[model samples]
Target: MNDGPNDTTDLFFRDATDLAHLIRTGQTTSAQVVQAHLDRIAALDPAINAIVTLNEHALDEARAADAALRRARATGGGPGPEIGPLHGVPFTVKDSIDTAGVLTQRGSPIFAGRTPQTDATAVARMKAAGAILLAKTNLPEFSYSTESDNLLSGRTNNPWNLERTPGGSSGGESAAIAAGMSPIGLGTDLAISVRGPAAQTGIVALKPTHGRVPMTGVWPRVPRRDWHVGPMARTVRDLALAYSILEGPDGSDGFATTPRGVDTGVGPAPQRRLRVGWFTDSGLGPVDPQVARTVQRAAEALRGAGVDVEEVTIPALQENNPLALFNAQHVMELKPAMAEATAGHEDEMFTMSTTMLSIPDTSMADYLAAEQGFERIRDGYAEFFSRFDALLLPVLPTFAHEHGAGELTIDGQVVDATHVQTFTVQFNITGMPALSMRFGTSTDGLPIGVQVAGPWHAESTVLHVASVLESLSPVKDQHPDL
Candidate 1:
């Protein structure tokens, strides 16, 4: 908390959309906006370790944006050049996503000095929308774990409580946004990477349907089918804005096919009488009572808002655990690539990556069986969505946990750290869209979040429901006391 004399210091806490409006209306200069966030990062990031690399030319980019805005103003209301919706706003990216000339070490020493010549599709799209890249955030090695610790960048601590993790592999991105270091950032989700971290840090994140956004330039590119690139922001509207810009095929990633009949923007009118399902546990593991209560409260809020909210159990979802399917697929597909990437530098690899490589091989028959089982899970979700607009569930079994903890206790029952993804992995397996948002605070003062999930290509529905819940959430405006 460096309380600067400049009035623009408070602007760092505003959402991306509002920041862009301030710049557009001449209320604030892009240079000032960028400087505000840069100053905040300088003051707050030391303890959090969220931002791993700062862009040296960020101020220069802000100056360029300011000049462009001045040029547009000189036109006297006549359009000269198209200004992006996010003009002059600053953003960050996960370390694994490529940024031209910026280090993308993927949280591993194996790629310690690696830098890309071209930006990832998502990065280029954000920049083209007038977002200045301020810095790169931290993640687990190759983004293999649910925590954000790594040998290259050490660990990213939760902004709410320094002793806890921010959740990963998008942990750094969420931590940065939570601490007001950046307004919004890009993160990749495979399993619970994006949504999990967002839940832990009290921010907003969207895991768009698989293929809704391009996945080009992401490292350790295994689990290709489940990998997703989405935006993490402080507001759902900002997430929608970024999603609109980042969606669609970029002609690079084969999986980035154009979505048919999908509405990327949030409409002005509120949805009416939507059907939603609420559940405390996905049956994969035990959930903290406080977390479960938060989900129930969200459902009741929606019910009060005129939405048809009901507590229903999808037996198909509860009967089988899909975590093993993901693990099997990941190990089968990524083992060869990991071996190649770290060929002679095995000692530099992190424990997670090395351990994943050591997993016993799965036969082709086993891989096929797992894929078939995954299809059944997808079908189950499709059937469930046909009856409801969205499902509300816990983002994690518990709130943020202590760093390096081998196991977590939920309701006096000890569970392995691997079960942290229990509630989130199903969506990845089903290729459905899911959004994580802050719903309430824990008894220990940590944030609790709930997941809003929808069928394939139904991101708009998911976001709409999240926006509704956000309006009724008591912790909507709450931020870490950092």
Candidate 2:
């Protein structure tokens, strides 16, 4: 694994939308676009262990997109124009999400032979937007762990440090983007599956407000109150673009509601100085000294950028009980789905221990009670947001943990490798929009991210603050050495 600064210019690392623009302008053909990404995936994916299945039909679609783009140009862009907003752009989907005709094991062995006959709502949206699905990336079993390690596809290594995790369930998507295997892809965040991986990989990811993106056809066929599918990309702007395409009620998924796209444009910038809350040293047990410093530096930089940065303590929110309850309820929702995904493969390596199931099962009644408690917590945040426009906090307690290692321990505390997702789950519970923007690196050189969260349905404010941080810190162009 080549670890220092990455300079894979021979590889295609530009934003997917930019590549689509090139195709639309005739600067590049879709066939060429597809080959470029496929070649890169073939060459670099081996190192990160991020890709599990490649779309064999990718080139055929690419050729069609090329023909369509040329025909559009010849007719002055007539007859339906290009098929999708991302027409011909190569992309990936987390293995947990279904792509028609593709294998979607959900990182478990029991469903090793499983295949879907229909595209997931998010995948269908991308296809309708003109995206050419390239491959399906790896993830933890049923996306239950914060670290990606499954019996079928092994583990996804962090690009920054191959020995460290990319961040779970969505690690493959995050690693693939970090290594430029694919420019942009979809990730589902129930806990921090999206944000955690993005934070560890130095990429931009968002878990849109609940019901913003349709979750139909997502495997495990479960309805998660804390999960939403969103975009993962190297640039925040690219994430915004993809989010615009994927947002809206698909009419099929009962959980999805809003169909509003990015027409709201970029929300108003903070007119008066914005009051930002920062939590560096939350007494959340042996907080990584490096993570604390990284977050502090980021907060200080935002303050320097003319924002009112307050060192406020969200103690009640910071405590894990409410978050734990929320996660337990989510686990309850997944039990049946888990049974389906793991059927007949219970004896597979890395299979869940009886103890793992017992925790959520035992907490069943408490899980329901926790659901009620979570509402109160969400209300508390609502009240807090009434005073402040956004809240800033660490995306993870520490930098990327060592890749391929089983179980994650921090500060002598054993956290469910999956449950450490506490940092990102709260915003999901409140149905608020949160952006995991790259801030800086840890002392050990792993990426550390800060969450920019806003009130429910206030995606504009969340993104506005994210854009400001993007401009202030300016970590967008940096890529990993594959």
Candidate with the greatest lDDT versus the true structure: 1
For model 1, what is the alpha-carbon lDDT of residue 57? 95
My TM-score estimates for the predictions, one after another, are: 0.96, 0.90
Q: Using alpha carbons, what is the TM-score of model 1? A: 0.96
Error of 1 at 335 (Å): 1.2
Tens-digit per-residue lDDT, 1-482, candidate 1 = 22222487688678999888888877777899889888999899999999998999999999998888888878867224478888899999999999999888999988888989999999999999999999999999998899998889999999999999999999999999999999999999989999999999999999998888889988767778889998999999999899989999888888888664565433335455688998996566799999999999999999999889999887766666788777776678888988888899988988888888888999888888888878878878878888888899999989999999889889899988988898999888787899999998988999999999987787888988998998898987888998
Clash count for each candidate, listed in order shown: 0, 11
* Tens digits of per-residue lDDT for model 2, 1-482: 11221233433777887777767666667787788788888788888889999999999999988888777767875435445679889899999898899998888776788899999989998899889999999988877777888878888888888888898769999999998888999998876879989999999898888888888877555646667898999887788888888888888877777657532323656448787887854544445666777678878888988888888766556544555676567666776666665566567736443335555463657776877778777777867877787888888877788754455677677765554566777777777788887888776777878888877777777777787788877465777766
Residue 224, model 1, lDDT: 83
